[model samples]
Target: MSLSKDKGEQNPLEKALAAYIEALQTKPVLTKAVTSGCISAIGSLVSQLIVPNPANGGKIVWRSVAAYAAFGFVVSGPLIHKFYILLDKMMPPKKEKTALDGIKRVVVDRLVFAPPFLLLFLYVITILEGQGHQAAIARIRESFFPVLKLNLQVWTVFQYVNVNYVPPKYRVLFGNALALIWSVFVASKRRKMALANK
Candidate 1:
């Protein structure tokens, strides 16, 4: 039996845990910026189908991607990082592991990180709809609630994956894939509904 631990000696396990924690502490700001940009790009591609009637002419994919990437890089990175730090301070976790301890992380991200994002996304939709006509805007509003519901549901799940499995560095890539899926689903369904109504 190792009596060193008995004497409150910090063994290899304690050392490793401490080191792992310190590594996590060194989060780079750039990582968040990159991640947000990538996800926005994914969303843009998905949104492409919805605008221009995919007819009159315009490159929705590139435009949406550029718009979202800028929003993420310029706006989201700083805001989200600050938001997380604030949550950690206000809702200091008993442990950073999982559960309410974990719940805290998810709640903070969802409650704080999501509202502005949703607003931004809605704004994007508005701009896209506006490009067409008043009728287009009405169509979007009609489809908005259902599409938004799906987007939220998917995002909730993705955020969990992002918070838990993702290191800060790779979070952007993972989130991008998820966002793409959500956008595709929403755009596709909205189109389907529109055609059926026609």
Candidate 2:
């Protein structure tokens, strides 16, 4: 009886996972957008916690969080989803996947996709935060290369695993999972730069 009960019972995590999978199938873009937005907001919140803002007496900046969330939902999620599709289309997977195929995808992702995307992120976030174009350019000048260096170092290994192992449908979700940490770093860096400029 206990064994049967245990088998029938589903934990919240399991139920949520099931729902997410279903949503992905039914509404791929929306699901990814919402998921990415939530993760981005969480990352921003975590950043605020870790590097409390002296400007606001360490209180959580809900506006900043909203900006991050909006960027994820409106930009990152859809763009990433399409980008992965493009990558796969460019280098269609083989019946027998090879190391070379994965390497090519990663190279293109890091070189072609990442740099422009990072610049866009900086620019968009600044705009979303109500900072003007000049601020965006300044932010880019200050952080672009350093952030790109770190991004390549970290995402190269992760992208290899993602492109090689993860299914095309789930690739954006997998990348978003990893992007949680990246988001935190970006949020923190953005905040730090803003403060420094002031």
Candidate 3:
């Protein structure tokens, strides 16, 4: 009876994993987008748990988490998925993924995508946190360059491997996996700043 109960409890999770894999196979783009959202949401939750709000007597900020999840779902997911497609179309990878091709991708991505995307991300998050247009603009001014500099420092090395080694279809998934850690860092910093301002 106990053995049966254990199996029953495990079945749902196993089934869900199987279903997710099937979706990845059948609908790669949508699956990757949804996967990005889910991963970002989880990352947000982890950040919130790690950082407490003294304003609310150390309570978790569900609003920030929800906003992070929504941002992932609405902006990061689909936008990133499409961006990868565009990157491939724009650069047209060589017959064999080579070191030079990887370098070219890294250069283009950092130059073209990173700046605008980072600005958009900061703007959206600022707006989502109920700050107005001016605040959003201000946040961008204050934060964008520093964040972009750090982004280059971290992501350049990773993107070489990501672009060169990972297949096109799987690139977004790989990026989202890596961005999971980045999301945690971003969410925690944003939350702390938000709390401090209050």
RMSD, model 3, all Cα superposed?
Answer: 5.5
Model 3 stretches astray by more than 4 angstroms: 1-17, 183-198
lDDT of each: 0.62, 0.86, 0.79
Regions of model 2 farther than 4 Å from truth: 1-9, 183-198
Candidate 2 lDDT over residue span 1-198, tens digit each:
222244348676666677788899999999989988988889888988877888789999888899999999999999998998898889887878778887888899989999999999999999898888999999999999998999899889998888878987788888887887876777678777878998
Q: Candidate 2 — what's its lDDT?
A: 0.86
Top TM-score model: 2
**For residues 1-198, could you state the per-residue lDDT of candidate 1 as single tens digits?**
243354356777776655444543565456567667777766776567563454547456565567677777766665666655565577564534766556667766777667656665556544643454565456556665675566567677677666655665445546656666767776788778878987
Error of 1 at 161 (Å): 3.3
How does residue 75 of candidate 1 score in lDDT?
65
Query: Model 1 clash tally?
Result: 3
RMSD in Å for model 2: 4.3
**TM-score of every model?**
0.57, 0.86, 0.80
Model 3 residue 140 CA deviation (Å) reads 0.9
Arrange candidates by lDDT, descending: 2, 3, 1
